[model samples]
Each structure stands twice: as structure tokens, then as C-alpha cells.
Target: MTSTSGARSHTSPWELYDGLTALVPRGVTVTTCVVSRWALVETDAGGAGLSSVPDDGRDDPHGPQDVVGQDLADVAALVRSWDRRLAAIGLASINAWCNTQERLEAHAGDVIDWDASAFERSGELVQGRRVAVVGRFRHLDQLASRCDLTVLERRPQGRDLPDAAAEFVLPEVDHAFITSMTLANKTLPRLLELSGGARTTLVGPSTPLAPEAFAGRVDEISGSLVYDAPWCRRALMQGQGMASMRGALTLFNLRVPA
Candidate 1:
């Protein structure tokens, strides 16, 4: 159910999107669509996409107004859409798109449930080593004091380096963790290329659990799997952030095979 075998066929993340869209069940109805702090869609079968972000009027032709009431199966296909910002719909599709992987995780064979320690596990690989983080995650204090860490953020804050620093820092780092939001913003491929020398991990909510998307580019995928659909839906509708909805999600890690 993990699709690691099929992963070899997908050379890019967009190709993986096409593969996942093909798996979305026909006749599935989208019961609710909410766009506030996060874009979310709920299907009749308790499926919910956790990372969908609504397109604010700018470059996106299809906004939340265009997606509400549409069938879940149709919206799920937006993962392959041309408008990169339509990723709000595409990210939501992860719930419907990876039904098989979710089912497999539910049975508890290969998936590692990290609960609150997923970040800790990610840091373990970089302990006492030179590390570069693509995004400025809030838990930097948890890393080992001896570790050499350089943070790169799109919008530089405090001591964190700007995104431009990636060219100079990534190749020299021993480990790197790139935010999975790169998938939605369409930056994963270039980031992977830049961080080729480091042990790279894709981290965050928008990360598709699909191994096919990561394949040889990412060494690990640190992401959350929605466990309580109602809680997740309510959080999205109320504009409450993921940091406040810990009970609704289970953190999981997938190691891409060598």
C-alpha cells in the first residue's frame, strides 16, 4: 500500500500527484469546504485534507468560491493542476488521494507513530553535526546545544538567514530539513538539488505521505496524518492553527529506501 515500487516511476512530485489522483474513489461526495486560516475539505467517509490553503485574490483563477460543493474526487485532481497556487485544493486532496496509505498506516505495520517527538527524531540525525533548516520551525531550542544549526527562511527573522543563503549553506551542511510546504509552493525540486550533499528531510503538514513524491530526493518525510476528522475540520473552520489541534493528528515518519 505504500507504493514504494511505483515511486521509482515518478521522476517529479507532480507525477506523484497524478498517480495519487488516480486512486481517489469515484462517487465520493465532498460534504464541507471551509477557507479561513486554512483551506479544508471533508468527504462523506471522514476524509479531510489538513494542508489546503485558500487562494487569496491575486494570481489564482479558482478561489475557494470555485471549489466549495464540488465533488471530492474532482477537487483531488487539482493536485495536477497548472495554477501552482491552487495548491490549497491540491493539499486537501492528500486525504482523499492517499486512502490506501492511510488504511495501511491504520493497521500499524510500517508507519512509526512519533506523537509529540517527531521533531526530536528529525533532530537526532543532525545532533552534533552541521545542519541547515529550510524553514524556521518554532522548536529550535530542542536541538542539541552542540549542534551547528543555520536556519533559512523566506522572510528572514532575527538571526535566521534569508532564503538566498541556501546556495552558500546547503551544500556544506551535514543534514537539512526542508519544509514540505515547498510542494505546494513548487520549490521542492530546486531545494533538493541545492541540498544534494546533506541528508535531506521534508517536514511539515503539507507534506504528502506519498513516498513516490520524495523518492530519491528526500531521505525522510516528517508529516502528520489526520486521525480525528471532526477535530481537524473544526480547527480549519474556526481558523485555529495546527499547533492548537495536536489531538487531531498523529505525527508519522517515512524513510525513503536507499
Candidate 2:
């Protein structure tokens, strides 16, 4: 959730990126080259045409051309030509949003409860600890509340990292729970970096549980065990996105030994 849209028409990717890039934040900038590559492939396979018009499209006085309805492969080729630029822009926008604090306080008091589908099966491991949640989505709140939690409504800033919510302020708190959606915005590594020294845990369906991939990154994993999804398989084939997909509730403990 990047909320760049206002009361007007839909916000273009450039507009959203421009609005976010104004702020600077201290977090690892995760480049979404893979997503860009996939998007290019999708466009190619789907046959969306490429446009020669500027991003805003208003600058082209001759007006925009009908790049749509072209061959899918041609569309994919055009996307490949512009993939780097698109990825750069997307990363910058993510950096901007990561630094903003505007949305951090929006749902501060929302209560989180457990959903039988995801966490109950793991038993009562989260019975009496304060938890801080990241990411924005309707169903996520349910999971957080079950853990007796508070929402970390931190919005991504253009430059500065969003403030971790009140629950994270408790130095004695037992755990910090993050979501797989963080991967969508390229903030998973940054979130790990922020929770580096704390008693935190990564809970999502997208985490890779291999000791080699997560040895120094996380402590324990708890979520869906997704080892057989088509996109995931493809990502593995392409040397990326190989994490399992256990129905979107994979949980990984982030404990490190002293």
C-alpha cells in the first residue's frame, strides 16, 4: 500500500513515484528487477502494446499513439527495452514510501485476533506477548489481533523509514511480526534490518526456510509451507522467487544466538 492517489483521477505510476521520492529514509533499497521482468513477460504473453509517449503523456504534443492491441511478444519486447528504467522508478518510489511516517499512526489501536486457518494450528505460542504488525490489508489485522497486538500503520516515506509502532518501542516485548506482502514493495530485507537486534519474527507465506538462505536473517519460520505453486516453480527455474507458499501464513522466527 502506497497511497499516492488523491480525490482526482487514478494516479499514474510516475506520479506516485514522484510523490514518494521526495523523502529520504534509512532502509535497504530492494530493487524489484524480478517483478519487472515478470511484468515484461506477462505483457508479452498478454499482448499489451508499448507506448512511445512520455510518462505523463501530456508532453507529447502530437498526442499518444495506440500502442495497445499489438502482438503480445512485441509488447513483451518493448517492456524488456524499458525494464531497467521501470525498475529504477519503482525502487525509488518504494524507498520514498518506506521513509514516510504519515500512515504509521492510522490504525494504531486496531485489535488483532487469530484466524483458525493460519495460526491456531501452531498452538498457543503467542498467548501473552505484545506484537507489532507491518503491512496493510484487511485480513492481516485479524492475525495481528489474535496475537494481542497493535497495528504499525507506518506508511513508506520517500526518504526516511516509517516509525515502528508503539508495540515495537517496548524493549522487553517478545516478538515482532512482519508479512510477506513486504516483499511486494521490496521492503522485506529492510524490515529484517530494522528488526535485526530485536526479538522479532517473520511471518508470511513467501519466506524461504533453507538454512543457507535464512541462516543469519531469521530465527524460526511459521507459516504455510508452499513448495508447489506454478509461479514459485517458475521463479525457482529462473533463479528467483523460490520461497514456499503455505496459503499466505508462513511464519519465521527471527532469533539469533549470542
| lDDT values for all models | 0.66, 0.34
Candidate 1 lDDT, tens digit per residue, 100-213? 345536535445545544467755556688888888788887773647889999888988998888989987888778887666666666777777767777787766666654
**Which candidate number would show the highest TM-score if scored against the true structure?**
1
Candidate 1, residue 19: Cα displacement in angstroms equals 4.2
**TM-score for each candidate, following the candidate numbering:** 0.81, 0.37
Question: What global local distance difference test value does model 2 have?
Answer: 0.34
Q: Which candidate is the best by lDDT?
A: 1
Model 1, runs deviating above 4 Å: 1-13, 19-25, 52-62, 80-85, 99-101, 104-113
